[model samples]
Target: MTDNWSEVDLVLKTMVSTCLANEKYFGDLDSVVGDGDFGYSLARGFEKLQAQYDELDRTDIGTFLKKVGMLVTSRIGGTSGPIWGTGFLRAGMTAGATTELDGATVVKMLRSAVEGIQARGQAELGDKTLLDALVPMTDAIEEALAAGATSTEVVGRAAVAARSAADATAQLVAKRGRAAYTGERSRGSVDAGATAVAVIIEQIAEVWKTRESR
Candidate 1:
């Protein structure tokens, strides 16, 4: 089964829950280069997600996601939230209720997501930004799909790629976010936003896999 709106909700819930569960891990790491609010922002976003769900009962994924995006932007005060908020909004626009979140959809959504972040944050791949992980995961998912892998397999591959890309950012100069202030010192330091996004996407993909297998 392709990932549906219900699956999207489940994935977001799981990702939010995982982020909350590992809040200290993200907070501790981000303290090195960020405001250390990644955990808080993510937790708030997840809580806001539940609020969005409660406020809106539309089965239309697009409507649901647009609302989600707006809520994230409003409730979460951070560059990451706006960046991710736009991504989710684009996803809603590109993907509707009839969509199954197939390989092509995932590729489009990922591309849109990165573009949305870049557009909002003025960041790019290799910029020690979320784009780093997002770019690679998108490519990996496409590759897995080209090889005829199932959604679960594609997600597994994407997750591996996301992890590698997140690690790679540590070696790059920060060109966006607070890390940009550190210049060369930013090198060898993983980006807080990238790491957070990596965790969210991988967790979401895993949830998607579980839905597929069920």
Candidate 2:
């Protein structure tokens, strides 16, 4: 089944709640390697986005997603602003005017987002950045979709993969972002960015599951 704008709205709400609740954890993760502002930045940004959520155009997914990108970029601070902004912006463009998304469509959108993040961040798979989580998540989504899984199933599988990737970051020496400055010391601590990515992906999956249950 195709997913609607209402589902997108629910996903955003879930993300806002998830980010706010885990803000301190994200900050703690970042404090070990970076500026310790990752959680606060996401909380502040998503809260602002939530405030204007009702005003967003719900007719077209592309327009809605583009608005989200602009809001995050303008309201958030640090490297996360541009990286997430570019990712959402590219995903929106890839989605075009679609009002509903299917398994294949979601995969395409995620792939575009991953590519955009890579272009903006210049990060690779093992960089211990959000890409470390997002890339594998997208790969899993694509695989699930190819196997004829529903959109919900695709996202569920992807979220699990993303979480695993985020956890795996603990063993990697960061090669990008502020964490890179720690050299080998970055190992043993999860990348805050990757954790954020996994958390958001899990939130999306939760929203979908909740919707399906209802």
Candidate 3:
């Protein structure tokens, strides 16, 4: 992939792609428990973000990310939009407007992103939202970085953590969002947001590993 992104941009790209891909996933799954419009809303929001990416050259990473956040929250009707949007913005902010991100910075950025999501959504780790995956994944990144793992290694471990966390969320009863309406019934289902988070982070870490090998 010739589209190289710095720390913030790497995350931004992930958001854009995950939202787009989730349009289908959300449509298919949301039909089961919630409105099918989740896909349409996510598609429109990310499509608008496609235009914002062109402005990247004209702005700093943090500014660009915040703009994306604002646009997503403003356009998309669902909780997913605001949650992911704010997560990206907070991550960029944590990186301190830098152009490059090493292991430590990326770890901090991930943690900040998770905090942002929690602050905005008021969802805890067991809420069966994206936080279920993101918090644990970022926690792994932080611990890996503290142990002197390379950026690639930290991200790889984080991706694995994210996936496992996402899977684990299936056994949890939802305490937030529409899924919460299902009460105990939500326990066997995977959260759309958490699955999307794991997918994107896995892709990112995979790319990082491939880049390192090359």
- TM-score, every prediction: 0.89, 0.94, 0.86
Q: Which ten residues in a row have the lowest lDDT in candidate 2?
A: 1-10
Per-residue lDDT, model 3, residue 128, is 84
lDDT of 1 by residue, 155-206 (tens): 7888888888898888889887777787888887888767876787778777
- For each candidate, the alpha-carbon lDDT, in order, equals 0.76, 0.87, 0.75
Find the 10 residues in a row with the least total lDDT in model 1.
1-10
Clashing residue pairs, candidate 2?
none
Residue 186 of model 2: what lDDT? Answer: 93
Sorted on lDDT, best first, the list reads 2, 1, 3
Better of 2 and 3 by lDDT: 2
